[model samples]
Target: MPAESRTAFSFNNSINPSTFILIGIPGLEEIHIWISIPLCSMYILTLVGNCTILFIITTEQSFHKPMYLFLSMLSIIDLIASTSTMPKILCLFWFNSREINFDACLVQMFFIHSFSIMESTVLLAMAFDRYIAICNPLRYTSILTNPRIAKIGMIAIIRGSVLMTPCPFLIKRLSYCGTNVISHTYCEHMAIVKIACTDTTINRAYGLFVALVVIGLDVLFITLSYFMIVRTVLSLSSKEARVKAFGTCGSHICVILISYVPALFSFFTHRFGQNVAPQVHIILANIYLFIPPMVNPIVYGVKTKEICHRVLRIFYQKH
Candidate 1:
């Protein structure tokens, strides 16, 4: 085929070229207006919910516990992750097909991955906290003291940020000789890397490696922590101790499942199930990215009684 014909064929094969396209479910445009309303509401709720969690944690003296510290870190990650993607999506829906520069896209991708990794790490840390609290309650205070918790939080942030730094740099090295249109809504690493005109073997390998490292390590550590926790709970002399331990870890587990399962689905879909409908893909993508933030505050508030009261107090005081 002639070069011009080849170019034309590639262009025709892809959905949109000028900008990233949001592949929604078939006939979704009919309900796009309605969908937009709820999605916008959720976006705002996610922001407020996470921000409120952060505020309460910062302001409330009683919430300075190790578990709440991890919750606060999760809230910060959720805030950054949700803000990194949603505002631009809302702009695209409301104003125009927003165009992101290459550098900006890279930056967005970096933060998205960074925050995601951090959330996962923070959850692992939370599991460790629960493990310490339940498995060795006698030393919980000594082991997870304020200064120690602060150190762990700092380590989580540093590790997550450093791990994701290579992603943007790797993406930058990839040549974009062809059209720059990204599929899906956000600057996701897989979606953007797919458009590289150069060989993307390294990109794919790196992505898979990073996913395995972050998700795999997190799941492993959490499972180990919970295993120890369960063993400890079972051996407890009183039923009350078991109940308390379970209660303390329940919210963290809920948040972990909410965040990790969707992420795994999206990762697998992008990696193995590319032929799926665009709308299905987009919906899963959005859920994978957004739901954690929206539900995080609720999980913490409902499960952790102190945070709930603190959040309510803040609202009541403001009014």
Candidate 2:
């Protein structure tokens, strides 16, 4: 019999309420301490940066506009998403605590994936906000009223929660007769599902479905929004007006690329890339979670004059 068959035959019975061992990075165990340095720094920066953004938005009444409201939502999502995984990861690296309760793992997985979906939707909403601001400045305020923005925020929360609600329950139904070692830092949906001894077609299919539908559709709409925005910008007669329109969009475009590129790469590698090393896969997964939350505030701080001015004002007052 094949090695795969032999391994399957060894653990035919299901084990309920298993404990999963998370190996920080499979091949890089020796450098786990060294690796913690940058990850820790990034996590700190993510907290400080996102908190600053939220503080600025909340205190400044001028920031009550749609654009800033969407940014505040994004900041909140980034805070929770990064916090959901980083603390446990740090513990794994520094204290060598690798064991996570199966139920806890499921909770982590749900929060991570759900918040990710919410972030994507918020990005899509931000794209729509840009589209209206540039394409129909006259109606921008009327179209994206406070109530409408509130509805968009509520929908993002509901859509993400509803879509990811099935993942943990689906995972619970499976039997983990095999070794319960998860090769990654956190309880990623597929990572947990892969250890199941039972048939996992439902979990796999549903995971793929959510990825394709949520990410696929959001990307499609964001692309179309930018396409229209570009067309409108070019139609403007003055060079300064065109420059201003594109300038407004430049930060958002950078943010979109930062958020999506690693995410797409990680998703494809998980589904394909059988030849890829485990360490690479695990590192990419960490990056997909870490980089966006860390980089978003920095990108916006540099590009947004209001945020920069507020920061400077805060510093000046302190001095």
Candidate 3:
């Protein structure tokens, strides 16, 4: 009856598991050539930016601090998140290779969601580091040692892997006889699961549960940490000290907003905005997941003065 339903119905019946065609950014097939330019630019920038941050943090002993440790972790997570989807997306756009194997699809979904969760977890660690630095300056160094930060990073990896390990199995159990055509460029869990001919009650339920459990707890802790940081900053005796303390938080605050706001909006849109155009949903999904990775390094580049100074010094010396 409806056009969208009709389109879905056709694709639903076309799946055979030999290969699923990824429809990249629906309704823009004619202009995909134009689209690849911008997308490739972003991928290149993301790689360069995140790698540069990693290089600076690793090589410079001065950056051997808890805050920079979290920053380094964030860069690595961003790299993982982008690599999970962007290469395939770029392939789809550039070579017109829409066919992805079923196992590959499953792998993509796992990495994308897992690294996303890990990134949020890393953010929580960073928030706690800042809270301690600002609110308990006397004990910050004593408490947050290099070993402790490394442990935090290990925990983040474990948390993401363990939480998301069951997800691929959930989808793998489904019978996808109807259609294998994925609407988005990459294999998002919901997008892949939606093609299942069988009842998807379990898949949907488990996904929501994980989202709420993992992201929900991380957000709660981060919010509380910031709340305490703000309280501690405001009570400081010297105006200059208060300003400096808050300034340390400003970059992270911007990063949190950039990462969470779009992601939450995209998540809700997928769940609630069923009537929204499929193209809009796909585009927003890309923005939510990809934009942060592309822009985060840029944000930190401007926000962290030491990073900027070091980068400039290297360039000047090379010249």
Candidate 4:
């Protein structure tokens, strides 16, 4: 019994696992290069799209409102979340490189989880902005000023980090006995924990707590905001005004559903989809997490006239 093996829950009580092996798409090793091609395309698209949105919002005068400010925040989060895991996946798929250092896994888990939580929070903030604009137009400007939006962004980051900080340490405390192999493309919290040869009740409980309490609350508030928005929209006297207001929220609504539906589906499949294959679950989870980074900007660029005009102008000027 060494000093380091004194965890609250220990099974093997042996030495530390120096490295963990990452796995993806079981039984598809031979065609991984082919898989990497499409994945690389998606990753590139995610980066370029999010960066373009950020660029447009930062440089354009008309895009500096609260909605676009939150869009910028989301772009930043999407970039971090997508990049945090994609490079590792590319290596795993293209180069057959699966060995990741213990500390590196911790860092990856931290960034992936933190940004994910932050993105969800930002969506919640965006919902609040929409609610204010539609339901309480007079107070919207005062409530969601640049400074206030900045504070909200900062709070989202801080809250996400503070909650996810403990996850890695919890896994680090456990003794990994044999086969430090994680059955996922990247260092997800539960995927890494499954390799631990110790009682993982607390780890599982904490992860569930964050998912249910922190993220679930965000979903609840977003729903409430939209509910109030619809109520207010219906109350408006002019049909054209109502149509215009709903149209303004159309992109955000689509983005919200796109982000949440897949996420909630993948989450439930992981936890309770008894007959689903692990590969299918992993693919759904990856899509849930990564597609938004690529799709969100496109939705905004197409739905938002100002953003679309600026984007096309930039392209024309470049060409």
- The candidate that achieves the highest TM-score relative to the unseen native structure: 2
Model 4: residues with Cα > 4 Å off, grouped in runs: 1-15
What lDDT does the true structure give each of the candidates? 0.78, 0.92, 0.86, 0.86
| Clashes per model (N, Cα, C within 3 A) | 2, 0, 2, 0
Candidate 2 structure quality by residue, lDDT tens digits, 1-319:
7332444445456465446778778889899999999999999999999999999999999989999999999999999999999999999999988878878999999999999999999999999999999999999989999999999999999999999999988998888887677788889998888888899999999999999988899999999999999999999999999999999998899999999999999999999989999888889999999999999999998899999999999989999
- Candidate 4 lDDT at 288 equals 86
Task: Report the error of model 4 at residue 300, Å.
Answer: 0.6
Off by over 4 Å in 2: 1-14
RMSD of 2: 3.7
Question: For model 3, how does the per-residue alpha-carbon lDDT over 24-82 read when each residue is reduced to its tens digit?
Answer: 88899778888888888988999999999999999999998999989999999999889
Whole-model lDDT, model 2: 0.92
| Top candidate, metric lDDT | 2
User: Where does candidate 4 clash, by residue pair?
Assistant: none
Q: Would you list the clashing residue pairs of candidate 2?
A: none
| Model 1 spans with C-alpha error above 4 angstroms | 1-32, 314-319
C-alpha root-mean-square deviation, each candidate: 4.3, 3.7, 3.3, 4.6
Q: What local lDDT score does residue 152 receive in model 1, on the 0 to 100 scale?
A: 82
